[model samples]
Target: MDAIERDDDDIEFVETAYANVAEFVEQLLLPTYRRNPAKHRWDPRWWEYQEVAMRLEALWRSFEYLRLEGPTGMAVFFRDYLDPTMRELTSENGPFWRLDKLGDERGVPDAWPSESPPRNMF
Candidate 1:
């Protein structure tokens, strides 16, 4: 069908926009955004962290979708995805929390202690 063909074309366009996650981050993201080191944390080894990797992938997909929408596309992406994601990602307690400002890994903190709720409590 024509709709299916169009969908396939759109997918191809998005997939080819960036060669990989690293390319997106290194080429487009890092250069454009500036972070205050005093308030935020970052590690060059961001891909090593599972949460960071997943978030970056989601951001990349969102970017690919929004970029087709013309002028307001990036505004929406920044408001909806980039701002919140970068805030959480670079927060002190974010996935990079294990690393110090110099990117040295402080000892890992123990996982948060938790227990299952009573049956049917939900």
Candidate 2:
């Protein structure tokens, strides 16, 4: 079943993408969460991360929440997944509609903030 295969591929792709997005969100939201594992238990996103990671719809909503929090760099996560229909959906005042249009909260560098990681670790 080619369609089944495609769905499997999508599932795997989304899972990995979700992990990257989640980690980036964590880094942005709280650079020190990793240092304090107990903080994760208090972070709503961290508490629900696993369940949402396994469900596409929930994952997308979580991503939208990230966008609202700070939309910068999110276009990368959905890059390959965007399709004509998906693009149309995002165009209609949707959470993702302005993803490309929204600037970073700081409206500064197109890159991650200095406090953001890959440089600084918790």
Best TM-score among the predictions, by candidate number = 1
lDDT of 1 by residue, 19-95 (tens): 66788899998999788887788887788777888999889878877777789998999999999999999899887
State which candidate has the highest lDDT: 1
lDDT of 1: 0.78
Tell me the deviation in Å of residue 92 in model 1.
0.8
lDDT of 1 at 107: 46
Off by over 4 Å in 2: 1-19, 32-52, 55-62, 65-122
Model 2: per-residue Cα lDDT over 5-120, one tens digit each = 23434622223333454554454434522332221122233333343234334444444443433455356435533232233332433222222333212111133356546755
